[model samples]
Target: MEWKFVRLLSIGQIRPGMKLGKRIYNEEGLTLLAEGAELTVSIIRRLERLGIDILYIRDEVTDDIVLPEMVADETRREAVKQIRTVYRSMMNDKMGRMSYPHLGYSFRKMTESILDDLGSREDVLIMLGDIHTTDHYLYTHSFNVCLYTLTLGMAAGHSREDLFTLGMGSILHDIGKTRISPKVLLKPGRLTDEEFAEMKRHTELGFALLKDEPFVPLLAAHCAFQHHERLDGSGYPRGIRDGEIHDFAKWIAITDSYDAMTTNRVYRRGMLPHEAVDILYSGSCTQYDQRKLEVFRDKVALYPVGLTVRLSTGQTGVVTSVPPKTPNRPIVRVIEDEEGASVQPYEVDLSRHLSIMVSRIAEN
Candidate 1:
């Protein structure tokens, strides 16, 4: 189908590979197709041409994890609403005090279906970051992990089966945490030594829970067990060496860490997305898998909209969008002068202006 997010998504234009988004309210804005689904790359480029910065991805969005784009197409919203229902139920059955082994298989298959849909085009915005969060933090974290891992898996060219396995394992990596005590799980201060030890048991606990499922794929157990294991063998449960670690675990480790650190928690405020990228970069020689660490620099947004930032020239403003091929530095829409006085709106490409440096990226 000829893909376009025009006056609205034209019916004839909705084809198998064309990524879709629907404008929900003219004044209120847009949403993606649903949680866990990605927009095809072609759609992103077309939207870019229209001077549209936001194209909705189908996935769960959280209150804390802000989606920079507020407006989206309406057709995309309907598609995503159904997807949200499916994801909510799948996670509930798997994590809630319920037994639904059969649902696990369908849930995994659903992940693969979401991945193969690179839209009909090569480029699309897979909803990796825009997750909707509620009271269930651990479960929400698992869902986000699955969404992010699938995006990285496709980017790294993993086989179809491998991607499916990765998604399934990631979605459940934290299941063991559900078994931990609520006191330790929700503690506000730094974890005591004893509390830390108890918390660490989740890895082993997670492994035990997943190892024997009837439909569990090969290595699903290791994914839960070894996601915490590092290349340097400093990780918990068992400090297995890198060679002993499966490639699947390696991929999960990077994505898992990235997601965990960037997200907010009761114990600590989360790092900015760019700061999280720096952590992954620093951990490369030690804990993180080198290859997998790259996904952050490429995919994660450094300066999300509404975040305040300082420029090398002493000017400051809100981030607009990271210019193409220049993600490290973005074009900011200036809001104030260096002295904090109000200023007129203007755009500057930090990538093109060598004199302009990002002194620091500060989030409010």
Candidate 2:
């Protein structure tokens, strides 16, 4: 039988001539390298310089696992293009009074496209395998937040119009960051108290930028404004508690934190999905809405396909599939024996094998 798996490797584990299993995109959402392209030393160096440390590769043991796309490439590319254009324009016009000619229409259409794409999927899970450069982290992050927010909104039985509003708010939630200095915004290390205070101003600045815009909805502006607010009033800006916070902003808050923790940055590696979820749960009913957090956790693929994991039985395997109903328990294809010997591969469905458990993610 043909084994279906994809290997996730770090830059240090990659070598010349390995075929790429996924497409890499540039800041403009353009394809930097096509899928199945051979990697060379020079190519690897260039990717490293671009701050890409992880990649998915096809090999003898992992060749046929076709990961599903939550949104089409074209849709994501166009949305990123729009985000870059609008954000850069706002940054250049520091006065924040200039009008964007088609800001409202463009984002409305993009939100609709995302909703449609997500609706078409039989089972949607938040998978984190997309390739992007560090320089364009904001734009990519905006798109991802929008995806996660909308998915949760749909799961909560939100109306179509509500989903559009949530999408718009999530996508442009960080528009205020464009006004912040790159030095502080892109600092490679932890920010000092003073610097952090300055960074926190983005919420108010974003509100000022969007509140009066002709095309932007007032609720959407509040999403940017209050997304940082926590349940117990420890958050920023207004320091509002549960009822004071808008439902939309509360939703955005969960997605924003989840994505931030799970995405790579200049300073640190991204945490695995399960790790991030654990942090989220720790803040339940205090920092986040417990009901919303539970919904978000259910929609995330804790052990995404292509990830390497170790089972409690001391066997190692590559994740092949994740059932939406039981995302925590994925189907793993064992490739190594407990004694560290190479063995004929076999499939293990953790949902059925109740005695077996995923001990940890392998570091390979």
- Give the winner by TM-score: 2
Candidate 2, residue 253: Cα displacement in angstroms equals 0.9
- For all the candidates, what are their Cα RMSDs to the real structure? 11.4, 2.5
Instruction: State the lDDT at 5 in candidate 2.
Output: 37
The C-alpha stretches of model 1 lying farther than 4 A from their native spots are: 1-100, 113-135, 362-364
lDDT tens readout by residue for model 2, 20-103: 888888756778988888999999999988878888888788676657678887888888888888777777775756356677
Listed in order, each prediction's TM-score against the native is: 0.68, 0.94
Q: Which ten residues in a row have the lowest lDDT in candidate 2?
A: 1-10
What candidate 2 gets wrong by more than 4 Å, as runs, is 1-5
Error of 2 at 115 (Å): 0.9
TM-score of 2: 0.94
